[model samples]
Target: MGRILLAVVALLLPAHAQEWRLTRSQSLTQEGTRAWRYTLSPADRAGRELWQKLVLQYQDHLRAGYRVDLGSWRLYFLGGRLRLEPHCPQVNPACFTFGALPVEKGVQDRFLLGLSQLLDQALAQARNTGGNLTLSGLFRVELKPGQAPPYLARPSGWAP
Candidate 1:
């Protein structure tokens, strides 16, 4: 029986290994890679709830404005404000936002653009509701493995 129990535990180890965690934006303040990526796992109930609310709001925004779909997505919170890139970043015209662009376009340019806006709003609302440590808009950072990120600008408020 002990041998069987030990085997079962070993088999379950990998399944339990993937836990949710937030990679603090402050920790990745440095220069190195072109961009940094973070995760918003299911374990983060508050974050996930906020994300769901933002999704509904953003979908409405897109449908009312551009008439586009929000597609599948992943979330990350970095330290900075969103800004519109004057020039086209690549082939995707959707990548060029009227306000600010995201750090990485990933293939779904339009969806990401719309989602970022919603994320900004949700973070602000969350902060106001209580002292919740909610994640805000994602900022561009090039944190090297060992180096710290330099001083960066925070969003002036919310984009009008």
Candidate 2:
């Protein structure tokens, strides 16, 4: 009886938990602007299916007037619609840009603080170069199931 119960419990668990693996990355600079591109892939077939489901759910939430917050970044559906391109292997791999922040006073310092939490050494190098250098390289980051999701709805009363 115990063995049967254990088997049932195991079956109740998901076959593949969501895990996004960084597959490719590249830093680019064009016309004095710097940006980084990353390509994330699932660990296996099950992960791929899970990723698709999450994307659909996220879209539905957005349609319902939910705002997405990634760390300090905030995104809202403008004009009642937000266009997201489909992820295509080798062509377009789910792009997310995080730079070109507004030049308002104190904005750069805050942005750098948030960035430093993610890549401390990179920011250190940039500081050493008198802010002329920017992060440029491919980095590996494994997203486990318990970690933060790709994005989440902003909490009520949240500021900055």
Candidate 3:
């Protein structure tokens, strides 16, 4: 009975278990404006699929102004770029708005263009080699000197 239950539970789990990670974070200048670049990578197959789906649906999401939930992070399309914020639960009484990492419009546009090309290349590579491919996004965050940078939460099961 224990064996059967374990098998059932295992069947319910995702085939590709993966989580997103902060692969890169650094300060940079864009169009003479101070900014920070935050790159999130999906270190495995599951994460790659999730990121790809989000990119594919980006146009529709942007048009509808929908908020996308990625692990503990919330994504908002604002001012012509993607903004990152911490996800707050509706039942949490202490929920409040924290500052977000806002990407510049020009920078966002260029990134998206490059991402499209990368995806196309990945598709070709996947067809040639029966291996999985992954992708990451580099977000250009506008810096407000007086305020603190937004806190990026560690997803469940993530270790430093």
Residue pairs in collision within model 3:
none
lDDT of 2 by residue, 54-114 (tens): 3444445555676433222334455543322222111111112223323442332233233
Give the alpha carbon lDDT tens digit for every residue of 19-121 in model 1: 2233433233457432333322323464445444544443344334432222221222223322222232222234332222232333223334334334333
Query: In model 2, which regions exceed 4 Å deviation?
Result: 1-18, 27-35, 69-75, 78-160
Cα deviation in Å at residue 98, candidate 1? Answer: 21
Question: How far does residue 103 in candidate 3 sit from its true spot (Å)?
Answer: 30
Q: Tell me the TM-score of each prediction against the true structure.
A: 0.21, 0.31, 0.36
Best by TM-score: 3
- Report lDDT (CA) for all predictions: 0.33, 0.33, 0.38
Top lDDT hit: 3
Best first by TM-score, ranked: 3, 2, 1
Flag the better candidate by lDDT, 2 or 3: 3
